[model samples]
Structures are given as structure tokens and as C-alpha cells.
Target: MTLSENGDLWCDIRTLHPAGNHPALFLDRDGTLIELVDYLSDPAAVVLIGSVLEDIWQANKDGHAVVIVTNQSGIGRGYYRWADFHAVQARLYDLLAAEDLVIDATYACPHPPPDAGGPAHSLYRKPAPGMLTRAADDLNLDLSRSRILGDSVSDLAAGKAAGLPVGILVSDGYGARDAEAARVLADDGFEVIRR
Candidate 1:
């Protein structure tokens, strides 16, 4: 795990070989991976979203890179520290390991969403595409064929903006609430994988 300058970005990379053209399965950490817990700062609260694991496992079997991209605003909002986030992440990895899952990399934007006048790019926050694009470059991903699965419109929108061809919205977390809005993006471009 490495921290970007200013310590607002967390990059944990474990890719053994750089395929350079592999399609990635980009998963959102909060609702899409573990069950959503608002401002989740406790490792004990970490629970895997059981259904998504099958897809991730299959992606692994298919030789696709598995990466997690998340917006951890709780760190920026003063609800938690980076250390807390790391503890939770460690627990998440342990749980995934128990299921025979391997994550190639994780890109977390620890900053909160930008204010109306603030530039989103500065923080690499979701809905901005910075994190996705950066991860693609770092992991040698094929964004044109990559798919991002998440529970928020921001997650899907970021995938679309980063040139991903498919966006998957899990029905858990905020998915049920943002369904209509997320579907609206499907009409614009990219396939929306509904769960």
C-alpha cells in the first residue's frame, strides 16, 4: 500500500504481471463490496456483499484484473482517520481472502466531495473519473472493455467518464434509490449492468 502526496490517496497494488490490455473489474468498496455502513470506521462492521463475490471470483478465473475504487469521504469529513480506514481495509481483505478472492489494486479518494465551487479533479473523487483513469494507467487496464460495479450514480458516472464500456449497479446500498438516475446514463452510452 502506498499513499499519494498529501496523503489523500491510497493505492494498494498487488498485480503480479502487467498484462497491459486486461479488462478490469472495478468495484466500489462501500456498498458494492462490503455492505454499506455510513461513515464506516470500524473493522468489525466490515461485511462482504455476498452476491458480488461470485462475479469477482469469475472475473479472477477469467484472468481479468480485480480492482477496487472507493470514495472515503469519512476521512476527509473528520469522521475517521486514515489509520481507521486501513484497519477496515485489512479486515475486508482478510474476509475476501477467506473466500479465495484476490484484489489486484485499490484506489481510494480519501477526500470529501467538492463544494460547489471546488474542483473535483483535485481530490480524485467519484463522479470525477480521476481515480478510475489513474487506476487504469497504473494497472495497465483496458478501460474500453473494463466494467465498474458500484451502488451510486457517482460510481457509474465515473466509470462512463473514464471510458469504461459497462457499468454495473448492485441493488444493495444506494443502488435501489439511484436506479432511475443511473439508468439515464445507459441511454447516453455504455451498458448498465443492473443487479
Candidate 2:
């Protein structure tokens, strides 16, 4: 794929080779799929907000692979261990399974900001598109046909930088400040704002 002068990454969707022209649905885990909490490590704290299950199920029915891309800075901040995060994720998977919503895969970044002295502003974090790029490579996803639903502008920015066809923002879970920033992005057509 050739890069545009604006530095937007481009790809040929027909070459990706998914059957029947299906698209992959990329979702942000914490806020888009479940209610955001303060570094939730407990398995019981996982809760599906609103119609997430139905939405995912619909995507599946529409012939899309449902994947989760997330950033878990709590691990780098020492607020929760990776093992605890996995336990919580396992419970979350079980809960989603009970609702008949199957997530194809989950990708995450555990690093924090460079100022925090964690991982030095790693590329895997949101707004960098590292995780999304890795997911596309591993899954052979067609970025031009895929969609990203996130709760912050950073998430939308990541989607944009990665060349996703659609970016959706969930208004809840994010704080007031981020929501306002998302509004600006939505107004600019950088993403579709959904509440």
C-alpha cells in the first residue's frame, strides 16, 4: 500500500482476504465494552454497560470479527498485577460468553507515560496505533473495512492514524474533559460520536 502525502497509512482491503467482504469490529475494552472503574482487579467488578452484548452479537451476525484493543496503564502504575488483570479479563470473557457475545481476541498495552518512568512512552499505547497495527498484522484484518469504537479522542486518533474506515466514540465512561475533546473531534468528522 502507498502512503499519502498527509502521512495516512493506506491498505488494499481486497488483498486481506476475509470471506464475503466482512469487516472486523475493533472495540476498546474498558470503556466501550464494560463500565470503567478505578483499576478494577476483582473479577466481580466487571459489568456490561448498556447494550454492548447485543451490539457485539450484531457485529458477529453481520460477519465481522469482534476484537478488543485496550490500554491498561494500571499494570505499569503498580495498581494491579498482570495476573490480576487476566483474572478480571477471564471473568469478563465468561460474562460475555454467558450473553452469547464472543470476542475474537484482546490486545493491550501495560505501559504508562514517559514521565511516569514506566516504559518510556511506548508505541503500544492508545493514540499511537501500535496495538492496532499489531492486531491487524496478526489477524490479517482489512483496516479499510474495519471500525473502531472507543471512549476517548486518543482512541479515535489511534483509529485515524491506523486508517480504519470508521471510528465510533462512546460518550460515557470517559471524564468530562475527554468527552469535550471527543466532541471537537466528532464535529471535525474525525469520528462518529455515539452515546
Candidate 3:
């Protein structure tokens, strides 16, 4: 069966039904939290980024919901299957849990590119506010206070489109190159920090 045959949206809630209207730190998986690996599908290859470990811990302590928003195009493109994705994610969760870092929720969009003859560009992919907006509604989060943290310009674009006030572009993955283009999105209270 194809990835789209399973569904278009993938959501996993780790919290025991968290109360709504909380501020969230919407994080990206690959290149943002973990080391960048092109279409990574192996659990053993997972490696956490040390730079944001403290920030994640602080967000939890500060009463912010730690959420992950990822685009797993590899799944839809036949590079990996859902089981592989779960295995990789389980590794990530295990590593974070070891540090006492809890993720409130996780969302993934398994839409393939147009070349795959599918509408992967629907509402849930990055650069579009679908996943973030859905997370806000599902978790009852306040978008105005939420922040998107990723290494791509798409993260900043999505945050701004979602009306989020902050977007952190880290130099972990593609941030160093995307930084120049992301500078323009840092207006009207939508702060874009290129680190």
C-alpha cells in the first residue's frame, strides 16, 4: 500500500489530554532537534542537537507545550514506510525522555511532492500553516504566543502565516543558507532569530 493510502495527516499526542490555550514551542524533527540526515529512516542514526536541549528543557519548565511538526515526504515517496518512521521517532523520544524533556504532541505530514502525482502540497506541509494551525486548534494553543523553530525558511514562513510571534532558524541544517532569505519575515512582531 502507498503512504497516502494510510492517510494524509499523522498526529501523535503524548500528553494526557493537555488543557488548551497554552503557548507552544513547535519544533521540527530533522535538522532542528536531531542532526540533519537526508530522508533519514534509521533509528540508530538518530542524534540530538545539543544546542537546543536547554531551550527545550526551559520551555517545559516555563509551562510551554513542546510539540513537533515534521514533514515526512520520504514516507510518501517510497523511501521509507510508516513503521520505519515510528522506529526513528521512538529513538528520538527515548533520547529526549532520558533528558526529562517531554513532548506534548507530535504532527507529521506524509505528503509526497507533486511529481509523485499526489497533492502533498495540501494544508499540512511546511511553508503552509496547516500543521501548525491544526495543532493550535487540536491542542487549544494560542498561535499568537507560539513559536516555530526549524532550520529552514519554510519554518519561518509557516510561523508568520500562522500568526505566530516568533520563529527561530537555527544553523543546524539549512539555517545558515536560509538565514538571508528569512530576514524579511521578521516584521510586525514576528521575530525571526537566525542563530
The TM-score measured for candidate 1 stands at: 0.94
- Residue 42 of model 1, lDDT score: 97
Candidate 3's residue-wise lDDT over 85-172, tens digit each?
8889899999999999998888888876567755845787888888899888878889998898999998889889999999999998
Better of 1 and 3 by TM-score: 1
Clashing pairs in 2: none
Candidate 2: worst-modelled 10 consecutive residues by lDDT: 7-16
Q: lDDT (CA) for every model shown? A: 0.88, 0.71, 0.86
lDDT of 2 by residue, 19-118 (tens): 4434678888777788988788888988887656677888878767777878777877889876787788789888887887777767767767677765
RMSD of each: 1.7, 7.2, 2.6
Model 3 clash count equals 1
Q: Which whole-number lDDT from 0 to 100 does residue 122 have in model 3?
A: 76
Clashing pairs in 3: 21-140
TM-score of 3: 0.93
Give candidate 1 misplaced runs (Cα > 4 Å): 116-123
Using lDDT as the measure, name the better of candidate 2 and candidate 3.
3
Error of 3 at 150 (Å): 0.5
